[model samples]
Structures are given as C-alpha cells and as structure tokens.
Target: MGKIVVSENVSLDGVGQDPTGEEGLRFGGWFGQVGDSDREEWAKVGFAEALGAEALLLGRRSHEWFAARWPSRTGEWADRLNGMPKYVVSSTLADPGWNNSTVLRDDVVSEVRKLKRRVNGKIVVYASGRLVRTLLAHDLVDELRLMIYPFVLGAGDRLFDGIGDRKPLRLVGSRTVGDSLALLTYQPIRDAGA
Candidate 1:
C-alpha cells in the first residue's frame, strides 16, 4: 500500500497560502523572507523529499501551478518532478499538460483510495490545501511533513482552516533546517480513543 504524505511549506502562524507571492495576496511571498543560506537549506530539504517520493498527487490548481513552472526548469529536483507520475484531482480539468500527468476525474475520495492501493511507495502531495483538508477529513493522509518558515502571516489562508474535527497526530520527527525553518514530520494517530 502507498503512504499518502502531505508536505507543505507554512508560516509560523500556520498560513500556507501564497508562499511564492504569485497570488498577489497580502504577505504573499513569505517564502523569500529568509536569507539565502536559509532558502538554500529549505530547497535541499525539498529536494531530498522529492527524491524519496515515488509519485506526486496534487489538486488542479496546484497541478497547473507546478506544471507551469517545473517544466522549464533544469535541475535534479525539477527533472525528478517533471518525470514523476503526477495525479491531479479535478472535476474540470480535461487534460493535464505536464509530463507523465494524469487527471483523476472521479469522486475525489474514491480516486485517492484507489491511488493509495495502486502505489507501493510514498505518494507525496504538495501545495494542495483543499485536497489536504479532504484527505484529513477522510483519514487518508498517512504522514504530514511541514517546513515552517520564520515569518508570521497573520491573515492568510491557514493549513487547517476547514478541517471538521480535531485530528490527532503523533510527532515522528523534527529538525531545524537552515537558520529559521523548522522541519516537522507527523503521523496521524488513527485510533479514536488514544
């Protein structure tokens, strides 16, 4: 069975929106707030994670976003991402333009469950906040990896904004990356009575 890992870059206040400032949201570009060394370390962490993932799962918007940027980039990370099997969950997307990309147009829950059974290794998800919430609500996510930046974006969309219940998680790993980033890994505690 595959492990559904939801990886995200978030602010100190848990805001995960507009990290690249492309959305034009207020406080959008928190991703570049740190120094060059810190950014380099963060990139290294992401590269390592990408190296370990067997496939990528994303929502439509995230798929479009990544497809637009990663296809033209040249590097080990970009190459890996561009070449990996990508599944995008969307009701409207007819064609996924990125390389090795597939559009999952069925019921999101059912499609993801099928995907989990089909994949043997890690299916990593990135920058798909809505899909992450759905996965969490349905108890589909196996691991949550968060790279927390130092800034506090007080007014942006947060990671856990619409989760219906208090899902408990057990901390599996944690480390400080670069000067100001906190790399935290968590596994969802599936038992209700724990």
Candidate 2:
C-alpha cells in the first residue's frame, strides 16, 4: 500500500498559520522565511521526496490556493506538484482549475483508501489542516514530515486540532537546519490485528 504522508512547515510553538502576520495569513512564505544554504538543502530534499510521490491529496481550500499559484511557477518542485495527479477533498469544487486534478466527492477515508490501493508510490498531503485532522482521527496517515520553523505565531490554522483519537508514532528521522528549523519525520506504528 502507498503511504499517506503529511508534510508541513509549522512553527516551534505548534503554530501553522500567519507566522509572519502576512496578508491572507500565508505567513509570507513560511517555508522560505529563514532561508540559508542548509535550509535550502533541506527543502530540496523534501521537495524531491514530494516529487517522487505518485499522488497528492489536498483540501479544497488548499487546492484552490495552490492551483492559482503553482501552475504559473517555473521551478522543478512547482512543476512536479502541478503535473502530478491530485485528489482534492471538496464539496463545492466540482471542477478544479489545475491540470491532473480530481475532486473527491464521497467519503474521504474510503476514497483515500481506494486511492492507496491503486497507487504504487507515495501519496503526499500538504497544508491541509482539516484533512490532516481527518486522517489522524481515522488512523490513516502513515507518516509525518514536519519542518518546524523558529518563529511562533500567536494564532492561525493548525494540523492537530479537533483530533479525537491518539495513535503512537515512532520517530524515524530528525535533522536540524542552519535556520533553526527542525526537520522531523515520524511513522505511525501499526497495532496488532489492525
């Protein structure tokens, strides 16, 4: 089965939104805020892993936000994400503006399960707090790759809000970048008979 991975750029204080108090609460490029050579390398590694993914799962809001920006980007990472098949969970979005994008109109868990069965590579999820909470609640996420920045935003969206259940995860990797960002990777431990 393909792994469902959540990769996000969050803050040290568990804040994932408006870290820089930028417009639209985007944090003014949170991922690239404190860029250095080491941080750049870390981003390259993360983006490369995302490029290897067979599919991308995004929330409706994220889909629309990215579709408007990434498709016009010229970098390799942007190209990869824009070109790969995307499964967007949405009720209002009947037609996504981006290419290689599909709407998930039914049950999120069931549809994601079906997609995993059919794919042969990684399924990457990025910046979808609601969707991330659903996957965590349902025990569907296989891995989490978090790039924790140094800044702390007092308010914004978070990935762990409203989670109902708890599942143990094992830390498989950890690295610190020059910009004080901790690159953490965790894998969910499977329970017996699960």
Candidate 3:
C-alpha cells in the first residue's frame, strides 16, 4: 500500500490559502514576502519531498493550477512534478491535461483507497486545502508535513478548518528550514481501540 503524505506551506496562524497569489485570494502572495535566501532554501525542501514521492494526488483546482504552470517550467523540481503520476480528485474534470494523470470523479474515499493499494511508494498531496481536509476527515493521510512560515495571515482560509473530529498527531520530526520556516512531520495517532 502507498502512504498518503500531505505537504503544505502554511503560515504561523494556520492559513494555507493562496500562498502563490494566483487564486486572487485576499491574503494571497504572502509566501513571496520571504527573502530570496529563505525562498531558495525552501525550494530544496520542496524538491526533496517531490523526489521522495512516487505520485501526486491533487484537488481539481490545484491540479488545474499546477497544470497551468509547471509544464512551462524547466528544472529538476519541475521535471519531477511534471513527470510524476498525478491523481486529480474532481467530480467534473472530464479530462486531465497533464501527462500520466488520472481523474477521480466519484467516491473519493473508495477510489483513493484503491489507489493506495496499487501504488508502490509515497503519494503526496501538495497544498490542496480542500482535499487535505477530506483526507483527514476520512483518516486517509499517513503523514503530514508542514513547512510553517514565520508570518501570520489572520483572516485567510486555514489548512485545518472544518474538521468534524479531533485527531491527535504524533510528532515524528522537526527542523528549521532556512531562516523563517519550520518543517514539522507528523503522523495521525489513531483513536484507542479504533
């Protein structure tokens, strides 16, 4: 079975929305405020995660967002992202334009469960907030890694919002990436006797 790893760049206040500013969100583009050195170092962290993953699982919006940008870029990170097998979770996506892509349009829980059984290594979800919440609700994610930035966006949509149940996390690892971000790795601690 494959492990579902959720990797995201989030602010100190837990805001995870529109870091890139492409979505026209109110707090969008906050991610770019960091210095070049910080950004450069964070890229290494992101690249390492991509290199370690066997595939990518994304929400429709995220899939579309990535499809629009990564294909035009050229680099080791872009190469890995563009080449990996991608699973896009959407009910309306008739065709996934990216190569090696599959669309999961119904019963995400069941389809993703099957996908995990078939995959060989890590299946990662990157900054797909809606998808991440769904995975967490269903107890689908095996690992959660957050690169927490120093600044806080008080009003933006958060990464862990709308979770109906409280899930405890087991901290596995942590480190400071560059000057402003903290990389934290966790695993959901299943309920007792569950």
**lDDT leader:** 1
Where does candidate 2 clash, by residue pair? Answer: none
Of the candidates numbered 1 and 3, which has the greater TM-score value?
Answer: 1
- Tens-place lDDT digits, model 3, residues 57-97: 99999999899899999999999999999999999999899
Tens-place lDDT per residue, model 1, 67-136, is 9999999989999999999999999998899999999999999999999999999999999999999999
Candidates sorted by TM-score, best first: 1, 3, 2
TM-score winner among the candidates? 1
Residue 21 of model 1: what lDDT? 98
Model 1, stretches more than 4 Å misplaced? none
lDDT of candidate 3 vs native?
0.92
Per-model TM against the reference: 0.98, 0.88, 0.96
Q: Give the least accurate 10-residue stretch of model 3, judged by summed lDDT.
A: 185-194
Candidate number that wins on lDDT, 1 or 2: 1
Stretches of candidate 2 exceeding 4 Å from the true structure: 19-32, 36-39, 192-194
Question: Runs in model 3 with CA error above 4 Å?
Answer: none
Which residue pairs does candidate 1 place in steric collision? Answer: none
Give the alpha carbon lDDT tens digit for every residue of 37-64 in model 2: 7577776777788677999999998788
Backbone clashes in model 3, listed as residue pairs? none
